[model samples]
Target: MANRLKRTSEGFISYRFAAIVIAALFFASLAGWIAQELVPPDFVERKAFYGESWRPGLARAVDLLRLHDPFHSLWYRFVLAFFFAVLVACNVSRFRRIALRSLRAELPAGAEELRKRPLSFDLSWRSLAAGPRGDADPLVRYGELHGRREAVDPAALEGFFARVSALLKRRGLRVVSDRADGVIRFTASSGRLRSPGTMLLHAGIVVITIGGLIGSLFGWRGMVYLKAGETAPLPPDSAAVLRVDEFRIVTGHGGAIRSYVSTVTILGTRGETLAAGSIEVNRPLGYKGVNIHQSSYTMGEGEFARASVSYRLRGETGRRTVELRGTASAVLGDGAAVVTALRFLPDFRMGPEGAFSASPFPANPALEVEVSAAGGAQRGWLFLRHPDFNARFAAGIDLALDGVEPVYYTGLELSSNPGAPVLMAGFAAATIGLIFMYFCNPRVIRGIATREGLIAAGVESRWKASFELEFAGIREAIRREFDESG
Candidate 1:
């Protein structure tokens, strides 16, 4: 009844609640699949973060599941939380039983339970050389037990059974009968039950991984896109900052992008530079518990940019703005300077729609730069890049436009969470549990007999063929002894 109660509880937990959690995970995966199939094309705009497009339909899905970062979603957290809870409960319940067993100083033998087990049996056989003395001979049992029925004699089978019986008794089983009919039985057990701990040890790993899943839900991953020649501070704890010093993209023969490289300085909390590295796809920079990689590339040129620092005073509102692109002509109240679009590339696309909208490469690389002193237009088209690269303004105000070096860089992904490790451990535990309980249950044998010349075989459980093989060897030894005596 105790075993039945335990079994019923496990059944309810495993098939009812556990099954439901598993089903929910299954449904979640199915929904994710459907989302993958339908949501992408319907979305018209692309978000640089998480690579999702800005579309009417995806906003709700993305926000609710945190699809911007799905693995860090609530659904995953809910399932993993339940899984960990189940594991904790299972460990507690199982250990409670182990605690009880441990309290006993040692395993006690219920002699009655050991004897009169269901598989008890008996057999009878007559000797070829018959006499009451045949029974009196001490070698009589040994000879018949010797078990080489075709070689020594049937008598050896009896002796072989006796030796095997003694070996079993030493192992703490009570022998019920040993006879010459090639049959033997004994009852045995070991705290060998303690060997079951292999299950717990293996399950521990999955528990750790489940813990990792929980961490991720509470965790966050943010990206820092650093362009060459520029820097931006990262978001707090949920953010990490890095500066891209140099960026390069190696392309295939036909200009298909093959690989990219970005040299950057990684920053930890408080805007501190933690490490400097050259990052790429397979090669990521790990520092401060985050990984940064060169995930993308873009085209832009950095030249000796000549720009006037123009700013409207603190209280000057309403269109009183000072914006600098390259060098531009501007009258700052009473001052004047030159404004030239320096180191101009042909095409630059930015925001939903903005300037530099043409092809950013050399196809139409032309800069229409204007230089005005004291609020007037003195503008001209400058072919700044060339096989010759020589383009300048008329009559020395001295603005030397130098070589335009391209700026290449990428976005770095930073993430940290504690849940992944726990989920992994739980997965490992369940695997080990099944293997130990199913693959290694020991066999309990009990022996008895109804006749003098025959042994009986009995067991509480069927074992692997090992039992049959051992029994056959014993029978052969007995037959050999009997044949020799005859």
Candidate 2:
């Protein structure tokens, strides 16, 4: 009675309300996560800080809604927490009833109930009476007792019951028997472990939810760029430091970068080594709860030890290379002309304000050169791509620009999340549960023996087709035994 009441309550919670709530929470969380991605935290902060007049009101609304960081938002977290509770409650209620019923040692239904089962059949001694000649045939019973075979011969009943019991065991059924008042009952079951499979599955979902919560609340991700041999402290408030031992880039046949490799060292605040390893694209290094990945690189202005430019006169036989540095003057080979290196830009760009480098990549190298000779001092832009900036110097000499050397810096992306292990365990548990639920189907069979004959059958498993085939084979074996006994 207690189990029945538990089932009734479980059905009410599971079907009437639990599923809908969980589904709603799941879709809500999903939508919030997508919205968070659309409104990036960095972009929102940039717009808000600059007070950009063109900013979309929707972006501000998203920030106000905390959709910029949805997973960590109060409402989303509450949804996860509530869904977790629902799963636990549903699992506990359903597991108790299913476990008790599946592990039952006795058959709960009577012969009439068994006859009404979907995958059940009957075997009657009256059928044996209708032989080839329609003659009264000798009856048989599989029995370990004599009292129940009052109308039929005891020996015949014993033989039939014995054969059937052995057959049930051979079919991998764990059998239990009871006898009283000239009647015998037998119950058998298969794949008993399946009862707990679904419970474990639910537990897995709860674990995964907890993991996600942990990650949302505590995990962090950031990028750090460092030059080779440079040691930099980790994020503010972190007691660790990262040292770049080396950085390398491998190029493929087409000069495309095939991989980015960084040999990095992790150290304590006191400069003691904690860990050292190499990281490549897709291959991250883990130390002290943090993962470092090779993300990108840059070449910034003034990163080079020296800057230089080469030039050739309009009718000169060879090009002259003159090394350049900050505010340096170099006299031309010709006594009539002079060149002054006023400024250098690794990646040159011109703006209304002034000259500057657009980025670290030295795509268009440039030098600000001032030439003074017998005529007067003239300033011009000498570009590596367009070298003929001041071709018509006062001294009738032309100058062509050359390349500028660059220094590179490596970018490493670091992330830390405390919930990874819990998430992994949850996924494993869920997979095991599914395997048990689908492959380890539970099957139960029951039988009653009388002086007249024996009636035995069972229900098909969830895999209905396979269960039907196995049941058919069991029936065939029973027929063979009956025919042979006759």
Candidate 3:
């Protein structure tokens, strides 16, 4: 039973299993994003978009697989959990290997073992004395005496090993030497933290996965539509109310819309305002851990639309402002004339029979009004953009359309995620780990120095070409040191 358990655990933590889990996560996330885009948020709209051909089959598939909201689905969460487990197991296994390699202090068994390494060389004193011969490098191989064991004086061997150890120490490598059976074995290493740095990177990935799971399980996302001067209850079980005080559309040159802003207020249960602020694209308003983002807007006639009209009587020196909504009447100049708003047209147009609106968008807004006085009544249009046209209807009173209240519903997306900070911390940790792993090149050099000459080998974690040059430089330095001493 213990052996079976061991086999299962080993398989679960294997690199092949980790790769399969990673692939599953990537494809799952991709499919989720595609489904989110193809399916509408509203159920009716999603059904309509699916059309008649996909009525039962595709619809059932989408619902059964939870494609519309895959991130929150049970199967996706299970996959994420599996992926996290794989990462944790793999990190543990890797850390064990790194610890073993870091703690081990044994040198290569013999010259043959050293020669099998990626970088290795054998040198003898006879060839060094002969000097460079026919392009044969003494630092790499001792010319014709390469790999040949030759006698060396004990005192000379001791001096040579001492100089090499000092050189390794000067180059920031930790050196350890052992003497057994007249053979001097030494090992030197630098940048021992490289493996731990790689382990840190994997641990950071595991942390990121944990954070994502927390967000998926506990977080909430919803949307709400609120018109100007309107209030609605917040979604996802919040008792707070979200109110839109005003909405403004900023236009740039050529009358193109630059941005839209919503002045919003969050009200407590007692109708007390908790927070008030403006929200624009990419900017969100936060209240009680809920973030409200301005997602979109729709234009149409609003139930509470109001028109601001300014009027002056024939004998009055100043004008008075009055608000009108949907055929509401207001007195002008102490009841000298009763002004009634008959119709309002946003993006006005003069039809053959009457005045009408070209579009719901407020461009060239105009208001039609009826003025009643002792001399009878007159009806005319007051243009908000072109106030000069008001003079045509100045029979008893001069009137101008100052402005009109916006009739737009601001769409706000509300979300709350407690794991965002954790995710950010994970990313920062991963970045630091990557920097350490790439820049801190770990290297190890082992050598056996004896009366029969020297055998050396080296290995580096990465950047083999650069390490080769560095190793060659070290060999040359050793050779130079010996020649100078002689």
Candidate 4:
């Protein structure tokens, strides 16, 4: 053991790498926090809008957390990497020590080494069954109100010497052959003699950590929404294409809006169909490694009344301004998909007795539209629920349904976390191991016997108040066995 300890002192066991790594992490975290505070933000406010910015009514949002990206920061990664390294090194350092201390190790050649450890017992078995029965003194019967019990009662120890010796010999109780020794040594530690629970806990942590590393290396996560008729691309690792066939919001029994359901079709990268599923609030669509969430829906209807145009065709291009209600004719030539502010609904609603009326969420939707150019009062009052709302407007041109804007699902978030499996496995293993270690029950007996009239002795049990209960139980069992046997 001295030599082993000496050898272990060479590397991690003595060098204290864990302490060093922890200190490094402490400093690194501090430095990162300071740097984050000291450095001026590398950001431009009110910058020109890019393809990622700008919305209908809201202004473009400024990106803040992106600057110096704390999570992706170099210092943060260095600290985490160093900490993980220390954990692995610590485990490796202890692995050798753990292997050397196995339960299969043989008992020492001399009990002297064990004797110095506060373990001693002077027990004799003789006072059983009024006398010894050749080599079977303890193996006798006792009186039972129902049936006799054939148990070893040691109260007959005095007359059962020869039989006791034989029993001990059969049990492999070896008396030492050392220098004039007649004392016998019995080593029996109840409950758990070998405690390896801590080692198992350490190993469980290692597995969980390694699993976390695997998940971090290979896990892919992203979110997408499929509005009606729209196709969305999967993440970099996905092989499927998702299309939202139809999305609708259905309220509860009393129109409480229980949830919004979306019918989605999963298409392979090569345009082949793979799967179809419906997703709703709280219920997400999962396929392979991707998850599609039913985020939101919107519906608005208006006519193709007035159209905004590039003045370039009208011999004016740079002169752009907000088109006021009723008199704005910046038209595009040759009639492409015309861009026009057909009409606007501040408070829109759709249901029975629902329309763009004066009442809030109007009972009847109205279209105040104007033609784009050189034409009569031919416009569109495209009803959201009813596609035939085209006829409800000023007539001339047949109002054909070019396209109706659907509702948008907002704040839809998605991501895949593989760490869940690892965490769950670790928790389960620890719970089961602990239960096995502490819950198993054990029983033991002790007695003394004499010739004339033997006296009952004691017993013991684990997992409760042991001493008194064990003695009482042994006395009763002895009395009952004697009564029944006679």
Candidate 2: list runs displaced more than 4 Å.
1-13, 33-64, 67-72, 98-108, 125-184, 218-221, 235-239, 268-272, 301-311, 317-405, 449-452, 464-473
lDDT of 4 by residue, 1-486 (tens): 998876665544444766787788788777667656643354234334431354532322223332234545655676787677666666677766655743333223343343333222212222234333412433332232223433333344322434443443443332121111322222222333223444455556666766777767867665554446778776655666677787666777877778777887889978888999888888887776556666554333332223222222243334332232333432334552233445644234545874553332323444434444444445544433444554432222223223323243322345565675786786666555455445533233222222322222222245345545544553444443443224
What is the lDDT, from 0 to 100, of the residue 99 in candidate 2? 80
lDDT of 2: 0.73
List model 3 lDDT by residue over 442-481, tens digit each: 8889899878667889955476887898889888877766
Order of models, best TM-score first: 2, 3, 1, 4
TM-score, prediction 3: 0.68
Show model 1 residue runs off by greater than 4 Å: 1-84, 98-198, 232-241, 248-261, 266-274, 294-406, 419-486
| The 10-residue segment with the lowest total lDDT in model 1 | 102-111
Give the Cα lDDT of each candidate. 0.51, 0.73, 0.79, 0.47
Could you give candidate 1's per-residue lDDT for residues 125-151 as a string of tens digits?
344233344556666546656642323
Return whichever of 2 and 3 wins on TM-score: 2
- Give per-residue lDDT, candidate 4, residue 176: 20
Residue 471 in candidate 2 has what lDDT?
81
Q: Which ten residues in a row have the lowest lDDT in candidate 2?
A: 141-150
Specify the poorest-scoring 10-residue window by lDDT in model 4.
175-184
